[model samples]
Target: MTSVQTEVVEDPKGLLNEDDHMRDMERLRMEIVAIRQPFDSVMRVTGRIEPVDPVTWTLPNVAVRIEVESPAGQRPVSRVYTIRRYDSALGEVEIDFVLHDDDSPAMRWLHAVQPGDDVWMTGPRPHFVPDHASGKQAAIFADETAIPAVFAILEAWPADATGTVWIEAGSLAAVDELPEVEGVEVHILQRAKDEAAGTTGRLFAAARSAVADVSGWTVWAAGERQEMRDLRNHFRAAGMARDDLKVLGYWKKGTSSSELDRMRLAEYARMRESGLSMDDMRDADIAV
Candidate 1:
């Protein structure tokens, strides 16, 4: 496992010598310390965009696999991701940018590039592994940002294992280009931002009901921060094991990635401090 730690400074161009500009540029690269790894080495993968499944394309060097480096003393993690699919043949990763000015450096880089543009690839440290029960099925709730990871996990599952997926998109048009997998069910939740009030709760109810009939149920949710928390709460309230759920805040309303870290970390801390054990909650739990 590997861990990564990164810090960003604005106007980094003023901090280096003329001959060391290249090294400074490399250091100035946008990075997120999502994981820590001792043996994890970052590879600058530069490849042509390789088109895979019809709905999904590859961003050559854009796909990275690395061990997580945990300078934070957290567990080691390593994960793979297709940051962007740049070319059907080669070049940097091609990531989608919604054209928002409030994006991180990565998002800015993605939005600023053309078809043949190059990108720098970095760490996969601090990876997240599915924490589901060995014999149980996995259910995923995601949006566009989380799709790649969801796909990775589903692809990695044992042949005998099965699962379902529920995706939320801005519109029905968002359903374009998806991976085709055997024994996986996909559902879409399309609603305008203003119309999405109370939607998370409704979906959680449906998911809870669906999980109730299954043997070993593991819940994974990603998307809007508030909705993600609600889904997590629903699982916890339903007595899902503490270790059986994974919730992520892919992004949030009107918030940049930099702004999201503190909120999510604080929320996670509160969740851990709530201190409601699985056994105690399980005893009082009722199925949806």
Candidate 2:
């Protein structure tokens, strides 16, 4: 229940020394901001305070747990968000939250929070890492929720890096703009409301035309489980080695993370054992 305020920055000399000769080298490093103290009650916004610090938290696949009150009750939602900006001068940790019209407590909070609104976050756990050494370049496939994380990775890329980025959204207008990068082509796909969840249409369709020659580069993708599976198959059919692609599910449609624990238990019981790691799931050996 800790009330989060603007973080205090340290080590002034290190902050100023690196800025003198900037060349897109400053990657968004992350630090663990653990729950130092438990909150006795919920936080009440008492006005806004901007955070000022250099090198704040930002990374791809990093999740933050947020507790909010909704029609059901007090619930915590672990969400995937992108860091829009980390302005140390303004002392603010800005994040882009995807909003929806629903009972999701997290979405409700995003819509309600204001300039003075304050919330606590606990994260900086090991989530995902890019396989830079696997290839000289890479391709990223993501949806709206994963767009920010994909961008964070690109920010840390070397100037000579080249790749493709395929982003799917509800519509073209939902997309704002993409960051300028050499050898990186941005493709936008529009999804209609009636489409079933976890479906992969546009991405698969563009595979041959845009993603054909990417076998030599690492492929990174995150979204629904079905889409991720389709991507894995697509990559496999394209002659990509099992070790050259990284795919994960940010979430599953109609599945809650809490319920997923129970599902795991059921699966374990049905299988009568649990002794498999991701590394063990190679080509033709992957099991959902």
Candidate 3:
């Protein structure tokens, strides 16, 4: 059995003794402590289908809401995900998973999930909602693994909200697998699709074009830590403010998680000590 926090109510104890009063006070204190504890939850979702599109999946919010169960009575360690699709009729929602080359907990979970078997998830807590009225557009970029996040962003965007998306894939075959978006001008840059399709070069060129016209643009790029940093520099040179761009090194090439974390920490320390700007990192060869 699990202990969950609940609201405390003060009830009059009819016992006419001070000892009884003390017991009641102690009980009240215990209840208060329990109430202060965070709610930890997880959900066991069954019968989820593997993504046929490779870029997105469909899982319903109903299952997601109920499948949340607490594993350790601690607040659920939920992650922010881009919802690829939410099917009301079929009662399903789709989430994109970033599958790295090596195994990690999240990747392992994705790999191990069977069609009939259930997967544990915690929260779909909403975070940022874009401003559609401001005439400002959302700019998104993602590599193969982070495509789910990109899809989630595109899926939730308002019907009239127009934007641009840049995706990097291994080959033309991978690019052909991309989903269609009505308002989004989706561009697939093949990174190593033979020697001809240079994805990074294509992305850099596309971004340069976007940065040239800053009318309605908020840029975001993820994947290939080094590439993200270089892209950031490219935008900065083109006159985009750091605030307008959201760049992240979702993962680095040939880096262990520990190494990546340490490298980031070291970068942070350097920035703090020297007050270096994004441009500084680019010149110093500090890849994202």
TM-scores of the candidates are: 0.55, 0.64, 0.52
lDDT of 1 by residue, 5-63 (tens): 33121222332223222221111122321221111112223334322232232212123
After superposition, the stretches of candidate 2 with alpha carbons farther than 4 Å from their true spots are: 1-61, 69-77, 192-200, 237-239, 261-288
lDDT of each: 0.46, 0.51, 0.47
Q: Could you tell me which 10 consecutive residues in candidate 1 have the lowest summed lDDT?
A: 33-42
lDDT of 2 by residue, 1-288 (tens): 212111111222332124321212232223222211112111122211232223434444444343343223323333334454344444444455554444554554555665534465433333454577765577777876676577667666667677777877764543454466777777788777766435655655665467677656787887776677777788888888866777776666665543443343344333333554333323222243
lDDT of model 1, residue 96: 33
Distance from true position, residue 60, model 2, in Å?
Answer: 5.2
Which candidate model has the greater lDDT, 1 or 2? 2
lDDT, candidate 1, residue 276? 29
Query: Which ranges of candidate 3 are over 4 A from the true structure?
Result: 1-82, 86-93, 98-100, 103-111, 115-122, 125-133, 171-182, 193-201, 258-288
lDDT per residue as tens, model 3, 161-245: 8778877766444334455667778777666524322234556566777657755687867666667777878877867766677
Quote the lDDT for 20 in model 2.
Answer: 23
What's the CA RMSD of model 3 in angstroms? Answer: 15.3
